[model samples]
Structure formats: C-alpha cells, structure tokens
Target chain A: MNAEDAGANLAREADESHGRTVAAERRALVQALILVLLTLWTFRDEVTKSVAQASTMTQAAHGLALPALAVMLLYCRRAELSRDLQKGSWWGAVLIILAVLAYAVTTWPFYVSYVRKLQFVTAFAGIALVVGGWRILWRCGPLLVLTGLAMPIGWNTYSTLSIRPETLTMDTALKALNLLPDMVVRLQGTELHYVHAGVQGVVGLGDAHNGLAAPLALASVYVFVTFSRVRPAWQSAILLIVAIPVVALGNLLRVLLHACLTVWSGAMPAEGLPRDVALVLSLVATYLVVAAASIVLDHLFVEEGGDSRVATTIRR
Target chain B: MESKDIVRTGAIRRLCSPIFGTTALILLVAAVALDPAMTALDIHFRKTSILPRVSLSAFDAATLPSFKSAPKESPFLDPHPDDDAGTRDHVLQRLQERDANGTDGQVILFVTYYSDPNDQVPHTPEVCYRQIGGVVRAIGSRTVELGQGDWPKRVEVRTVIVEQELANAAIAYVFCANGRFYTRRNEVRLALGWPGDKRVYFSKIEAVSRFERDEQPDLAMARACKLLSEVLPALLTRHFPRQADLKHRAVGAAR
Candidate 1:
C-alpha cells in the first residue's frame, strides 16, 4: 500500500463496529438538528416566555464546550460514517417533542421548587443526541459524548505534582538562587522577595519570578502531540495521565521564579525586567523545553506491540 | 466521501428506519429550540456560598429593609464638645431618629475612599478604589469616603447578638488591593484604617440573623462593642480633623 492507502488502513483498522457506526451518523445529526429547529419553531411562544425570565431560570441547559467537542468528534469520524447513516433507528421526533415539553413545563417559577430533578430533561436530550449519534454513526464525533463526562468524572490520581511538589519546586529553585554571589533571598509563602546589595543593583536579571503554569501546560500539550503521532492507545492514556503532574510542577516552579525576580529587583525598575513580561515569552521557551522532553520520553517508552493491532499498524 | 470506498459503519443506521431520520431531524429541531433560551440564564447567587445562609433562608417574602437615609454620620453621639464645623453634632443627631423609632438593629457598613492626609510616609497619594469598592460590593452597600468618614470620635457602642445568619454571612470579605484580594480581617485594616478615622472602625455588631441573635448573646455583644470601638474612629476622622488639618499632621510628621 502507498502512503495514502496506509493512512486509510490505519483509520479503517480502528475497529469494525466503530467504523460502521460512524458512517451512519450523518443522517441522524441532520435529522436531530432539523427536529430541534421544528419543535422550537412550533413552540415559539414557550421559547419567548423563557427569554423574559432567563435571568431566574432553573437548571443551566448550555454547556458550549462539551457540545462543541462532541460535534468535533462526529466530524473526525465522517470518513466511515456516511455509509451506515441509514441503518439507525428514528425516535428523533419523539425526543424532540419530549424535550420541548419538558423545557416548557420547567419554565414556570414553581417548577424550580418541584422535585423533578429539573436539569434532567435537557441533559437527557443532550446525551441522547451525542451517544445515539455515536452509536448510529461510528465517527469520532460520538466520542465528544465523553467530554460531557468531565463534569462528574473527577478522579484521584498518583503524580509527582499531586505528591506536593511545591516543596520540591521551591527547594530546587531556591538552591539555584543561593548559588548566586551576594544574593539575599527571603521567601514569604510562594513569593521569593530578594533584596540586592550589589553594585548599585547593576542592570541585570535572572529567573526568580518565572510563572509556573506555562511549563506545566506546555508539558501537557507536548505529551498529547507526541501521543497522536506514534499512536499507542494505552501509552497515550498513561502519558496523558502522567503529563498532568509534570506540567503542574513546571507551573509551580515558574510562579516561584516569577516571584523571586520581584525580590531581586527592589521595584519594577523596567517593564521588560518584570515577571509579567517573562510570562509572555516563557510560553515559547517552555513549549520548546516540554516538547523536547516528551519526544525523548516517548521514544524511550514506545515498545513494539507485535501482538497488538496498534503496533502492527505502525509497522506498515 | 463516496459509498464504494467504505471501511465500516454503525449498526443503528442499518437496523433503524428512514422514519427515525425524521425523528432525528425533529429532535435536532427541539434541541435547537431548547438550548438557546436555556443557555441565556445567568445565576450569580451561586458565586457566594454564604448568601444562601442569609438571603435564601430569609422568608422569601422578606422585602428590602426599610431605610430612611439617616444623615451620613451616626446620630447617637453627644454633640462634639467644641468644634468649628458644627456639622458633627448635626450628623450625630440623625442616627437618633432611627434609634428613637425603635429599629431593632442599626448596622451601617461604609467604604470610605480617599488618601488619608494624616497617613505617615504620605504613601504616594495612594488609592484604594478597588479595595473600597470590593468592600462596598461585598456588604451590599454603597459608600464614598471623600470628606468626613474617618474621624475616630464618632464611634459608639451598640447591642450585640452573635448568632445572626446575616452577621455570620459576612464570611469572606474580598478586596482588590494592589490587584490582589485582601481576604483576611487583618489585611482589611491596611486599607480600611483603624477606628480613629471618623466612621465606625469596625464597630456596632448587631445580630443580623435570628439564629445568631438567639444563640450567642455574649459573643454577639462583645463583637458589637469591638466593632464600635474600631469603626467610630474612622468615621470621626472623616469629619472632626477634616481633610486639611489631617493631611498637614500626617505629612508634617513624616517630614
């Protein structure tokens, strides 16, 4: 197979059931989208009334991020989805009618006091559309259903960052600060207020107040980018999990350094010689550092899964 | 995007009907109709956990409190022994009407905003707009500290009731000082100043909630007296010393 064939094969080999499922999803999305519009148009009175009292409504129906991600997942699976689009069941109208009725009933101020679990209706509709679309249409679009899970799916994790790396971040950074000649550092909480008694505070600078979030966020983004390339589902998941701490530690250290610089310079003498400016530039520097680190770590860990379907795909 | 280049598809499409297509289209329409208005609702009550304890638990029918704009100063104080301004006595007299009318509690939280002329070091014409504004917002009142609220002598002791829900609802005080929330009570003093300023230093604690009013009588009284001690100075400072003399003393002492 040529490069194009190989790329298609990788996607084709994802899982037969998943491939067919995504192909059939298009009609459903279009159907659902249309059904929603019709129900809304038919019941314009209810929709209008809710707008008048929108400020005091019960249950938030809008979570843009989750729906947007779901839509994207559907789009990614568009390659295999168009074929199976016809095989899906059609309870779309019934759901549309039910959701509108639920919405209309919930609009009354008294419904807010009722024990109807008021938010349940819209949540059910959103889930139905996403999961149903995913099952009927096998594209990544349905995977966006998982994004909504973010609300209730928090978990305790093991990571160096979670292990209270604030101490380690500060200790390593402060040790580096102490090595400098004639530098007096005073740490108040996370702030390292340094007073310089050397050379009329010669115009100079060092990493005292570098922000910590940038390094951590960059590390996370880097690991994600690496995982998408070599493509091991398990390694990708593990790395994604581990990268949280790596990035978090990087961020804590950055903030520590950011505060340290303030002490180093008695006052914000110059705009460029400030922590705020460092924050802007540190983005690129950190991305480079994090990307390099992940590339190295990813290569070190990537094993030939000869028995695994994922490993065989890469060999081709 | 063609049918012949097919890899795989979901079983629902193969197992389901063209009629479901209509249903899918219908639900899509419903989702569109429902989501727009639903998304528009904005709830700020959720921002503060303490608000529910105070306002939420209050009988829903409880309307806004009856307030007659008492003149800016507390009317309880005996007339200033001797003063050029004459207005200090006038300001103190106003609080008497509310007291005489038998309003069970008179608790006024004010945010005075001005550079203290008497502040040592002259602190560079410092400003506390955010800090003051934050306090004003937090307490759900409005105040402008331009002229006479800092005079300490204006403070007086009032009754205290500790177990009040509204009183305890004063849990988190947020102020943006130097672009940071000065959240703690000790931190509040840096910008709030001591009672010496004409207004209540932190004086006059009334049990705003029924629970606290009934539960901790002594603690409430102590808190009320403590509040009066702190607040009266700040309020009086605003008027007695007046801005001109106060600035001279503060700036001059530094010099």
Candidate 2:
C-alpha cells in the first residue's frame, strides 16, 4: 500500500477507537442513571411520606430542607464531578449486591420511614459506585449522604438524644441566671420553674424546644455541603465538635430570655405565641451562633493548597 | 424486529438475561405489590360532619343527653374544633353529654374521620391528655363486647388513665381504619404500612369520662365501650363504606 493510504487507514482506525470509547462511556452513564432513577421511583412513596411527616412535625423540620440543600450542593458540584469521573470498581459490585439485599429487606414495610430511606440511599450510592466507580462516589457521596436528612432519626432516637442535653442546657441556664437577684429557678427534667418576685414562671423544654436535634441536623448539613469548600481535616472536625455547644448555648439564651419574659409579664397569655413561632425564634438565635462560629472557623481553617483533607483522607 | 434478532443484540440480551432482568422484573413487581395503597388516600367531599347525632335510649335514660357543638372561634386554640385550620384535618365532632342519673356522670364523645390516608389519625389520648395539662399514669388496651348473641360484635379500645390534681378520669378510644378497628398504635401503623392496602375513611371515636381514683381503667373502658357500642354500628354504617367494614371485619374479627 502507498504511504498516504496507510496514514489514512491509521487515522480512520483511531477515529473508530475513540468513537467506541465514547459509546462505552455513554452506556455506563445511562446504566447508572437508569438504575438510580428506578430505585428512587420505587421508593417515591417512602420518600414522600417522610417529607410530609418532616414538614408537619416540628422537630424534624430539617428533613424538608436537607434534600433540597443536597440537591443544590450537587448542582453546584456537577461540573467538578463530571470532570472527575473514574473507571467502575469491581468492589462496587459488592455494594450493589448489598444494596439489592437491603432493597429486598426494606420491602417488608415493617421498617420505619428513615430506615427505608436509608436503604434506598444506600442502593443509590451502590448504583453510583457501580456506574462511575470510587472517584464519582467520593465526589458525589456527600450529596447522597445529605438526602438521609430527609428521613427523621426516629422519635425514640430524637427523645433519647434530646432529653439529657436539653436538661443540661436548662441547668446551665439556671446557673447563669443564679447571679441575677430576686430570681429563683428550679429544673425538673425538661421542666423549668422560676419564681421571681412571687410570680411563678414555668416553661417546659419539649421536643421542639429541646434544641439538640435541629442544631445537630443543621450542623451536619452545613459541614457536608461545605465539605468541598472547607480546608484541612481539623476545620471540618472542629465545626462538627463545636456544633452541640453552640446550639446548646443558643437554646440556653432563648430559654433564659423566655423565662425573663414570663417573670416580667406574669405569664405568657394562655394561648401564648404559637409553638412554631417560638421555635423559629430559637432557631434564629441558633443560626446566629452557628453563623458566627462558622466565620471564626473559616478564618482559622483557611484552605491550604486548595485541597480538602477529607477528600485526601478518603483517597488514602 | 424479529424476537431472535432483538435477542441477539448484546445490550438488550444482557439486560434480559436470567439473573439481572428477572431480578429487576421481580423487584418492580414486589415494589408495586408492597407499596401501601393508603399512602395518600384521597377522598373529596366538603361537609361539616360525617357522623349523624347518635342519641340512644341508654344515654337518655341516664339523663337527657345534651349535645354541644365545638366552638368555632379561634379553632387553633380549642382542643379540637370542627373548623380546624389544617386543610388535611380530619372531620371532627365534639359533643359533651351529662349523665341524667344525677350521679354527676359526664362523658365527652369526640369523633374524628380522615378522608386522606396521609392525614394521620390524631395523636392518641396518651398525647392528648398530656397536651391538656393532665398526667397520664397507666395506659392499656382491651377488647369490649358490644352486642349479644351468635354474631356478637366487639370493639377494641385503648385506655389512658389520667390524673389532673384532684380530678381523675379515663379516656377510652378506638381507631377504626379501612374498616378494621385498632386499639393500639402499632396495629394501626402496621395495617397502614402494608403494601398496596386500599385506603378508606377511618374514624377515631374517643369517649372521655370521669372515674374514681380507685376505679380500674378496665372498668372505665368497659363502660365507655358499652356506651359507644350503642352508637358504633349505626355510626360505622353511616360514615364508613360497607365494603371496608365488611372486608376488614371478616379478616380481623378473630384478632
């Protein structure tokens, strides 16, 4: 064959090979997408129910915000994720298998809403792994993880985690108020009793007022969403570590103010401000504390070498 | 377009292969099969009350039964107003009856119905009692026989023994959903969670009565059930569809 003809043949062969690679990539993407879509569609009822419950229930208000935030974060990171796609993992098959088994188990309907959603998320993660391998999972996993907030951590769990911490916060509030003259404060479980100038002020730190669940939930969302932006392992760790105290302190402040109001007003009117309005007031205080803490943390943990430590740690 | 030709395509064939394709098909079927039919039971009707006033001889014999409508002003503050703000709020009827026997017997019958399965049955008396400044000490469940004879009807109820300072009382309530009566919370949840189960109108019939501190909740519940039983059949027939009552009763009567 002539030299020019041979070169043309080689060029055609290279073009064909590239086309084949692109086709393969497309196939994998389609497979992954379809699997995830089907899994979500199958569990839409569970998802809807959990969302509805979360929206209605005061304590689980985080459930509604989480998925939406996660979606936004995912959208923000889409470019980076697509740029960082990696080859499929054999280990991903193991995840897919486990997820399938979980899918089957969750079908029984005996599991609570959160457990079912947890399983569904696991299956989605497994599908992602099988489709795009480990890199895609690590890059995109946080968004999937955030979807978990859509499911409420069961009421029993909420109660267990809330009661002690709230009681502690109330105790701390009483101690802080002890310095103030003409105020007598006593705490019984989650109930607060105050007698100032013979005016009895009683406030109960209920599930909504517990101040534990919302802060933890909000903090987790903050950390996970900012996982990409925050630098170093220690900063994210510090953010998580400080979340409880910030939340507790905010709650303490709110309760103290509320008690003071009760003492001054003799009592909140029988109907009082709605429970939800009160919860929002506390949450506003919590947001301020969290925001201030986040600022200080951001300054302290300035990104080094433009790399996230958790991402690096996962790689290792 | 031939079946063999389609089967020869590697992608289609691989997906349709015994393991993956079969598994997918089975799972899809299982998901559909297991999906709760009542996840969002939708019934569209705008009315004040689903249940008619059930005035019985016994209720009248004890003392003339007095019917009082739930207050309309500031429904959010009221215990349960008929004009609840929640669009999905269950249709509720609250009537307070005084015992005519001069024994100072007072009973409050609170009837609630849900047209949407997603609209949950209201918080049980355990929660309701607590919300209303009462301390609940003991909670239990029991089945009460309402009718006599070969085909005797029975109603299951949850009893909450409550104490508010000097006043002592018992709250006995039954939740009838999809035609099945559930006294306990878990039973109702399980039935509602069951995959593809049809959603139907369900009612929460709650009767609250004053009881002596020494009286057992069982006795109070039995009395409540007897009083409730007088109107239950007629109420169920009027409010719930015949099929829901018949099918659920047939399947769950033994339980």
Clashes in candidate 2: how many?
Answer: 5
Candidate 1 chain A, run of 10 with poorest lDDT:
A152-161
- Which residue segments of model 1 deviate by more than 4 Å? A1-179, A187-192, A197-227, A256-311, B1-255
Writing each residue's lDDT as its tens digit, candidate 2 over B46-136 gives: 1112222232211222221333332334222225322342344233443333333433334556666565545554566665444444555
Per-chain TM-score of chain A in candidate 1 equals 0.45
- Candidate 1 has a TM-score of 0.36
What CA root-mean-square deviation does each model show from the true structure?
18.6, 11.4
| Regions of candidate 2 where Cα sits further than 4 Å from its true position | A1-33, A90-100, A103-113, A207-212, A228-230, A257-316, B1-30, B33-255
| lDDT for position A82 in model 1 | 52
lDDT score, candidate 1, position A106 = 50
Tens-place lDDT digits, model 1, residues A1-316 = 7999998887777777675555445445654555445544645554444333332321111222334544554454444455434433334334545655665445431232111222233434543444355344323322322322212110111111122344345545666666767776533333344545552321122222112324433442343344324344565556566666656555554544554555555545333455554454444555565567655554554453335564454442
